[model samples]
Target chain A: MATRQYSFYPGCSSQKGASSSNYLTSVQAMCEELDIQLNDIPDWNCCAASIGYAGGGELPRLTLSARNIALSEEHNPGQEIVATCAACWLSTREAAERLHEDQSLLAEANQALAEAGLKLKNETPIKHMVEALIEDIGYDALGAKVKKPLEGIKIAGYVGCQTNRPFGIDGESYENPRYLDKLVETMGADSVPDYEKKVQCCGGALAFSEPEKSQEMVKGIIEAAYDHGADMIVTPCPVCQMNVEVYQDQINQTYGTKFKMPVVYYSTLMAVAYGRSAKDAALNGQVIPAKKLEAIAAK
Target chain B: MGDLNQAMIEKYRTNFLKEVEANVEEGEWVKMCMQCGVCSGSCPLGKFWDHPPQELFMMIRAGKRDEVLSSDSMWMCTSCYNCVVRCPRELPITHIMHGLAHYAKRLGLVPESQPTAAFAQMFWDNLMQKGRVNELKLGLKLYFMNGFGDGIKVALKHQKIGMGMLKTGRMSPMEAFGGHAVKDLKGFQSMIKKAQELEDQRIAEHGA
Candidate 1:
């Protein structure tokens, strides 16, 4: 098979935190096995997240997103821009759609980019790395690479709000959604029943904007997962992982509850299926201990 | 003055909850509150409120309109929706808080205990005017409007963060008057007009 290449944009959380670090290595190894070259974009900037630039006009936000896309279009040919972070996935995907839908805004944003010695034509398509692996590469192919099947493990999949809500590609829903869960099942694990808050926000920046209020939102999601008896949470978004993990202590203290649900990146979980070391996936750095997971792997 | 049936009010409770969800994310979960004490017990702020989760729901269920409207607990809810998360039935207690808060404000109840409401108004104002929120200006306005000098002190402590935003061309307070965000100023004006009209109607219908 010809080696397919992709330009991956690891958003801020991936750079600043350990979750993405663990995920990227495992994803890279999987890409290698699948004959895909997952390369990072040079000098990439933050996606400003989906909500961060809500105060700025569309142009500034669009311009910021387009600048990153422009680099991918200019430097790489044919490959889509693969965003590992949900915020980046949504922002970059919106950049492509919005640039086409609102021409006048696109013109203004391009002019701003021009001053910075860059141009954006929205030539490259923005795709989530998961989309590439599952949709483009095919799950059967991914399944073939799994050396150690995740049998008897029940996994709950969380697709943060941005990837599937407010605005996203068609055929996505909060009710009985099974794409990520199927991916988990394909790796030989049982996908747990869907819970109410699976697609909810992990409080994201709102947690910082209103700390006390944000803690409630976080606690609420954790409580829902607890209700479902989920052993771990597998998500593709780093901000969700960051928010859900960082606030575990606060949520535990406030709710008088003991929720030890581990949050694993989908890529990290897939890496485990690939028979790669948990350490290679940086599993130990998780806020919710995956000791059971580690023990299972040990056997 | 006529007596409203309890079932009739409960039937429309879903609609009221939906309205709160529209302003929030994961709003559907609000209607699922099972009256489980998990939310009350789990709530960090429950002990402080006179009308805790159970009481608030009971009042709503019984159509104890006067009691729910009169209480200060409604305004104190931070819209955290923690109750919804832990509620065995998933009642959107957070949305309830927001709806009741709005209703209280509309009824001319505790008109001053509405910092978050003012924050919402200012948020929409900025959005209507500039097509975005300018946190620097909004923060200052919110601080003064809330009459909390301590918030100003806290904000000032984060001056370096604000300066970095300015340096990055992200914190242009001057844009509040005229900038890319307010390019089509007319659209913003119309939005503000619509908001004011809505507020006026609310006050007329629900104001004391």
Candidate 2:
């Protein structure tokens, strides 16, 4: 297949040395295998993430994402803007949608953009990486390139919030998004189609601000995965992956329940299944080692 | 800040719902809620909140301004958007929750020692400096937010995770000095300033 191109927005979490930097690494490797080109939008700023709302207000929050969209429109021209971070995709897409609906807001946003020597035409389409993987690169094509199928691994596809709600991928039910499970099946793993907490919330940014409440929510997510008899959990959002994986030790200590579930990205799974090395797949980034996938990669 | 708060109270009188409609982002949607309670039921953290989304909407309509504004319930929203999609009235419940939080912050009515509000301010301040977040500084600030003594305790508790992150190269100590930034820092700051000013102007006009 011909190489498809997209303007990539790697948000704050996926930056070098950031929480999800390994996500960026694995995505780069996976994209190369899939014959896709990701061009970085020059000097993209923060999406002002969901947590920023309290201080960022409305217009400032919208402008932050608008600035990135404007930069992509200017530099990458016709390519659609793709964000691997779920928050970035949601923020940027919300900005684009709101701007298009409100002409006055668009005018005001352009007024702010003008300070940065830019203008937002509000014409670009913002998408999450999973949308691109499922729509642009179909499951059949993705499955065809899997050099080493993960045969024995039992996987629970965690479609946590942001990507699953408000505006889910094309034709996906909010209650049950099957794209992640389908991707798992394509990689020849046992997909737990009925993972009860598949669309549950991992408490997003609140994991840092309200640890007790957020950890309670995270406990439910990880506990459900274990109940499903899954070897590991896979997710698309960096926040979901981080919250569910990193808090297990603390949760175990607090709740007196030992949990050691490895929460990894869909890109990491694809990279390993495509016969990439553990380093190439950035598997070392997992706080709880994905020992199962690591063993698969060792093969 | 208190002056704006006082002036807003006098301006809106007892009509709290109308005041919210004029001030909050997507505040007008609050009136659209039919009290189906799906948003409250759908929220994963609803049980922990003092006032769930449905109760908050009810309170708003009941003209419980001081109680609603000072409540910490809205800060519990993780932006999971479950409430948004499940709202039978399509109230944009998530945005309304955030809008209420922002409005309370603007009026300086956020509950005292609210962790979410405090962290949001720290994050905004950090981002404004370099156009991107210096995660190291922000994390350090969060740890020390309560006091030096408390900060030390929290830091020690999470030291293992920090070391693990550093060992895996997921975080860098060098970032504490100077983190990533947009190339046109001046322009970015000015654009943000312009947006804030415009928002203030819009709010002023609405008040007028």
Candidate 3:
């Protein structure tokens, strides 16, 4: 598609030194190899994530995201707003959908925007970066860009909650979405398709609030990957990566299970598949040492 | 405990479903819920709730206003949309959960002891301050919110992950101390102020 360009919404997670900084850095490196250009939207605000839903009113949630949308529209014009974070994708997309569906809500959001001299026409479609690769660049084309396919590594694709339910990738099943599995296959890696916790909730940021239950859920997810003999669990969301990897020690201490499963961004795998350096893929950002991927990349 | 039971059986209490549908954002969808256990079954923290999601919806319907609002079920939803996707009725069960949470929170029904609710409020406060969230500040604030002694214990507990984050360059003290997350802080705050103004007016109009 002549080097497709997208308006990038890094959200808060991708900010410098945040949890998903490596995820963003690696995604960008992968995009470069795949001939995709990500244009950063100027002064984009937060995606108003679960906070908007969990604490604030509906209009406030819509308004908060609408400001970002209005800015994206002004900065990038009519280009699609592609969010790297799954929470950003869901909430921003939800705001866009809400604004589009209700005229009164649209008017109200616009009113909120009018004060800041920004208004959303509600035209741009919000997409997750994974969807863009599968839909815009196709798996065949994506594989064609791969200079070094992950041949022997067994990757269990964990779609988590955001990327699958509500607004899933095109042609992906809700019960057993294989887009991540398919992406892994396209990169010439062995995908653990039978991995049971592919769509299980990673408990989101509940790990911070209700750590015990969330850690158990994380245990189920990581252990399922191990059960299927996956070398690493690859996910699209940074929050999932943070919860999956960061909470492992806590889970181990509480549950008395010794787990050393490595959770990595799909972009890290994608970047490596495209022959980007392991360093460029930010493999060091993971809480667990990515020894398997490091060994794979060395060979 | 006796007073709580008395409040639950009181007929003069608020019509919970009516309040939800009238005021809560996505609460109108609660009526479409078929009492199917899909939402409750799909919830990862299903057993943790005083009343599981399906039963809570029924509670809301039966005008168990005090009981439904006071339950931890709303606060327990992690914003994972498992039930929303699996719902045969296509009801947005996740948003409904959020709506109920917001409704309960707005009315001060949620207990002061709820950590999840406290974290969520801190999340909102963080975002409102900077139009962004800072993990370092957030973690510290969350800890201190629980009292200093407990916060220290929690910090000590998480030191391993904290060290991992530091070594991996995911958490930087420089960014924590000096970074400005919102590029145009003044402009962003003005934008938020306007949004809140509209929201305040909207709620006042509804007398909610």
- The DockQ leader among the candidates is 2
lDDT of 1 by residue, A77-157 (tens): 667898877767877886688688777657766656665456787878788887787778777888888888887777778
Which parts of model 2 are misplaced by more than 4 Å? none
Query: Could you tell me which residue pairs clash in candidate 3?
Result: none
DockQ value of candidate 3: 0.63
Cα error, residue B136 of model 2, in Å, equals 1.1
- Model 1 per-residue lDDT tens digits across residues B1-208: 1112233234445444433333222334444555667767755456657888677666655556556655766545533345555566656565456556544444344445444445555554544444433445565675566467877775665465455334423345664564333243453344334333443433233312
Report the number of clashing residue pairs per model.
12, 0, 0
Q: Indicate which candidate wins on lDDT.
A: 2
| Order by DockQ, highest first | 2, 3, 1
* Candidate DockQ scores, in order: 0.04, 0.83, 0.63
Comparing candidate 1 with candidate 2, which one achieves the higher TM-score?
Answer: 2
Can you give the lDDT of residue A160 in candidate 1? 60
lDDT of 3 by residue, B1-208 (tens): 2443343334334666766776677788888888879888888888898888788888889988878877787888888888888889988878877887876777668866887888888888778778887877888898787789988998898888889998998987876675547677777777667776777666545542
Interface RMSD of 3: 1.5
Kindly indicate the candidate among 1 and 2 with the higher lDDT: 2
Superposed model 3: Cα runs more than 4 Å off: B1-14
Give me the overall lDDT of model 3: 0.82
What are the per-model C-alpha RMSD values against the true structure? 12.1, 1.2, 3.1
Candidate 1 docking classification: incorrect
Native interface contacts kept by each candidate, as a fraction: 0.00, 0.78, 0.66
